[model samples]
Target: MIGVNDILSPGMIVAHPDRPDWGDGQVQSSIGSRITVNFREAGKQVIDGDRVALQLLSAD
Candidate 1:
């Protein structure tokens, strides 16, 4: 099944569902279930899309 992360592309804005302190993040790259994001407050983070469902903030 296609998950939300599966549709996420680079440049899309997102937020960590569990780490609100990480603040908003921009999708740098997404490969399979691995997603690399640069957070506003936490810097770069490689999130496991299979484990975390990042909330979509903006597609543009």
Candidate 2:
């Protein structure tokens, strides 16, 4: 498990496998075991529904 400090904040890029094409995203919220991500798609930032019950990708 990774601490909140381990994960970067909003505007920070992250890797999300669910969005393989867009592979990068800006953090929106981190709560419990889930992290909300907003990915840039077609020149627009949209909420990615890949947040629920996800594992942290941080190196502990």
Candidate 3:
């Protein structure tokens, strides 16, 4: 399981299992291992917090 810290910067895309195939948005910020993302789905602000929905396109 990779975290925000593993990410380089925002605007990066990551696919979450529970979430949409494109829900993954740019990384807003990296708090320790927590990654805050600007979830934008059809111009809608989605809440992206813990439970980052494993099985996502993480940065390896």
Candidate 4:
């Protein structure tokens, strides 16, 4: 599970842990356990932080 410190904020860059096809993503929002990311290839998606730990690429 991702802690509050580990939680990413808006405009942060990230990548999917399991889906390379999803490509690079930009974090839209991180609220509680819900994270919204807009991917370069796969578009925007809402991820459950409790279930999948997203890899942070860079800060906003």
Best by lDDT: 1
TM-score to true structure, per model: 0.95, 0.46, 0.46, 0.87
**Global local distance difference test of model 3:** 0.51
Q: Which pairs, if any, clash in model 3? A: 10-27, 11-26
All models, RMSD in angstroms: 0.7, 5.7, 4.4, 2.1
Question: What CA RMSD would candidate 1 show?
Answer: 0.7
lDDT, candidate 1, at 20: 97
What lDDT score belongs to each candidate, Candidate 1 first? Answer: 0.95, 0.49, 0.51, 0.85
Stretches of candidate 4 exceeding 4 Å from the true structure: 1-5
By lDDT, the better pick of 1 and 3 is 1
Q: Compose the digit string of candidate 3's lDDT tens values, residues 1-60.
A: 764435445555554456574465655565554665655562323334465542335453
lDDT of 1 by residue, 1-60 (tens): 777799999999999999999999999999989999999999999999999999999999
Count of backbone clashes, every candidate in sequence:
0, 0, 2, 0
Pairs that collide in candidate 1 are: none
> In candidate 4, what are the lDDT values of residues 1-60, reduced to their tens digit?
535326689988998889989999999988887899999999999988888788888886
Name the lDDT value of residue 36 in candidate 4.
93
For model 3, the superposed segments whose C-alpha errors exceed 4 Å read 1-5, 42-60
Could you tell which candidate, 1 or 4, scores higher by TM-score?
Answer: 1
Most TM-score-accurate candidate: 1
TM-score of 4: 0.87
